[model samples]
Target: MKRKLIYLFFLTGSFIFLSAQVGINTTNPQGVFNIDGAKDNPTTGVPSAAQQANDVAVTVGGNMGIGTTVPTNKLHVNGTDPLRLQGVGTGNSTTDPLLVIDANGVVKNIGTLGALSIPSPAVFRLETAQNNFLQAQGAGGAQVVPMSMIKNSIPGLTYNAGTSTITFPAGTYQITFVYEAQHNATGCTISSYFVDFPLNATTSRIHSTGAHSEGALSNHGGTITYATTLPANRNWTISLGRGQSGNCSGAGMNLSATSTQILVFRIGD
Candidate 1:
């Protein structure tokens, strides 16, 4: 009887081990190596139900998904939480830098947006009021009489009232300076010159009117014109003078508001 019983017991144990579902924490495992336990890797003596399911897969490459089973890209992220990239280390000294990759595979932070460019349009003008003039008197030789008022000026041009000068951007420019001047010098021959109009650092002749006679005063007026290429980012001023030739020793020159004016034109680059 003992021999027969032992054989039956061995047979029963063999059938259970081969046919029954292999499980560790529980009597039955839903799939191979469930999260809770597995046949090959089991809970040992611990007790817990294995994971409910398994897709039978492995991470073939670097890309892996979180909160997702089927990852579409490397380190794919999912779920309801927002993702963000953070900066590390000092951007130049504790200043956090924006992330960027260089051509040589170097990451760094840069100050400033790079270089800047300013636009320059051709064809402009700077004109003063017709009443603009200098009260120049006591003529000895050529004298500089600065234009006093600016009615209008082009963009990128600034006029200084204290210096009577206009500063403009730096570039090669075809500029022309015009001046309308008048003098009221009694008893002597009167002449008008454009000081700084030609920008010669010397007086350029505009127009001259001879005296009528002694005690006979008449208005004398004329215009000066000079054109050429000028330097950029420089200050320029146009002035009107009287008795530039030193002929009107005893007479004085006055500019008229009705006829006196200063006009500057930029016709080329």
Candidate 2:
């Protein structure tokens, strides 16, 4: 009786070793290692594709497949919701990229690119309303151009009508200001116009148009554009007035001028 039991055990171990395949809930294994999760695989022959839906397979070549018998890649999953990852923190920034796939199907982050990417710009536009005039400041003097209406503006900018100022965040910005006006007094003329805005606490950039002389009741226009990087968050005083070298003293300009426009665009941080 002992010799018979030893012979039976050896035969069972030889069968398990020689088969070179293992199956759970299945007698006919489709891969080197397979698990029929639903226990509905066919008792004989191969299971249909529908019956193989609830299955996990590991091929002899070390390819793993979830819900598939034949995997094309190292790890292939064939389901509507195939894979999911958990425990990913909630931090997202340009410096720390989330996940981006390259042209060759390789995953990468911003750190791989070795540069900090800039975000899209925030734009704000302010225009004069009907019957609105830009306040006329004499030579060497500047006054904020009051914006009566907001044509189109984005967030992150604060506009105060009473102060006629805009608070800007720390970033590189491109500012554009344009205005058209005519002198109201007879024999009054302006040699030039300029824009004054604080680049920083100690410095202010002036953009002046060249020689826009106009007689009384003569219409004139000026456009100034400048780009600068601010080191800190501060208020920008958008002022349009006559330059110091102009003959605009004792002359009223911007009378009922409604063609003023101010555009502030934040390019990058």
Candidate 3:
């Protein structure tokens, strides 16, 4: 009867061990599961990954690893608050105004915190508007006159004596000329003449025809009148002679007389 009791006790102990082994195997089918490294804990109702042990608690002046509570008064290389430097012109001026990434993944210029110290005489040039002059009238007409014709013995007065063919452009111009004659004796007559012609080669002339034999010498002046529009470039000459049939080049005609003749030309729109 004692032998039977021993056998039954041994059988009970063997069954208990086998059941414990079976339960352990059923709980973790994968053999790779580690009891210490498992995220789930069966005791204390706390997850192994979420709860921190008493020994793992962060102490003063201790560096906190990732997933751990940070210590008080500890310097965080990459903390929530930004790390800033206090000074002026303490960086590489060549590569300064640099945009660097902060601890929070924000990009900002390092130079914005302080006043920048730059070189002097940094010029900022600006361009100004220029004034220009344009020629409204082209090269034609009395635009082509001899230099000798625009002069006078007196300073203010200008005289033109020679014959010049004025080829006008395709526009109308008021042509004027002054003729002065100082008659020392009577019967001295002076004539100022002008001719107007069309592009078709038609011609006209303005002159004075009368005899003056009075003792009292008086200055008589009259202007020539004619208005003809030019269809194309044409030529017209002014000839000043002494007497009728007296050509421009003749002796005793005084073509170079001291009396003045001024040719005034004005252009209008």
Candidate 4:
């Protein structure tokens, strides 16, 4: 009886050492370490590709694989929705963390969404009103210029002809306004003009216009560009103010051909 017991122990030890592979729920091991998650692996020879769908394997080089017998990377996963991460909070703000893939195909979250560049298509333009005139007002007074046409505009921008106002959406924008004017009266001279919006009272600047020699024939223009961020929707307008003589005539100031051009484009949040 002692000889029989010793022989059986030697045979079991030799089988474990010679095979050099461990398998759970599978007699025919397909890898260095295999787990038949569904107990569907074949009992005879190597399992087929279909049977490997229910198997997890680890290669001799320490590469692990799910739903596949061969693992080419450190952690290879196959099948639909093979990987999922829980407990990650919602990322809805610009300061929220973001997942990015590196050049080596490794996943990382080293930066926030604000650090990335995104495409934005928010732009607006109000232009092209011929025969529009700016009535000359004396110093310290202003006359709102007329913009009758909407040459180009997008959503988030609205124009009201009744109020002579333009409503803009909440965002940071680079705004540019250009105008072409000429003196219509001999005695009147326009020293300055401005593109004004109530929200931009402090930042808006007066553009200088040199004296015009010809009463109605002389041509002059000014352009102003400024950037601002609006926390909410706001209205904007253009006006002629600052350094104007009372002698300026009614039809003395005229904007012809694409005058009173205002272009606004959103740059950021």
> Sorted by lDDT, highest first, which candidate order results?
2, 4, 1, 3
Per-residue lDDT tens digits for candidate 2, residues 1-269, read 00112122366446322345778877777778888899888877777787778888889999888887776668877777666889977653423545675664445664511133233343333454323232345666666666654643423556666777777656666777777666555444545667766575544557564444354456666778877766555776566666766555665565334567776666656
Model 3 RMSD vs true structure: 31.5
TM-score of 3: 0.28
Candidate 2, backbone clash total: 0
Winner by TM-score: 2
Off by over 4 Å in 2: 1-99, 111-136, 148-155, 185-190, 212-216, 255-258
User: In model 3, which regions exceed 4 Å deviation?
Assistant: 1-163, 183-200, 209-220, 241-259, 262-269
For every model shown, what is its TM-score relative to the native structure?
A: 0.39, 0.59, 0.28, 0.52
Candidate 4 lDDT, tens digit per residue, 98-129?
A: 77766755567866433443423333233544
Please, what is the whole-model Cα lDDT of each candidate in the order they appear?
0.41, 0.61, 0.31, 0.61
Q: Give the C-alpha miss distance for residue 135 in model 2, angstroms.
A: 7.0
* Model 1 residue 102 lDDT score: 69
RMSD, candidate 4, Å: 9.5
What's the TM for model 4?
0.52
Q: Which ranges of candidate 4 are over 4 A from the true structure?
A: 1-101, 106-132, 146-157, 187-190, 198-205, 238-251
Tell me the deviation in Å of residue 20 in model 3. Answer: 72
**Alpha-carbon shift of residue 200 in model 1 (angstroms):** 8.5
A best-first ranking of the candidates according to their TM-score comes to: 2, 4, 1, 3
Q: Pairs clashing in candidate 2?
A: none
- The alpha-carbon lDDT assigned to residue 149 of candidate 2 equals 40
* Tens-digit lDDT track of model 1 for 111-189: 3221111222222122333332334344424443345554443345566755566665433333433433344455455
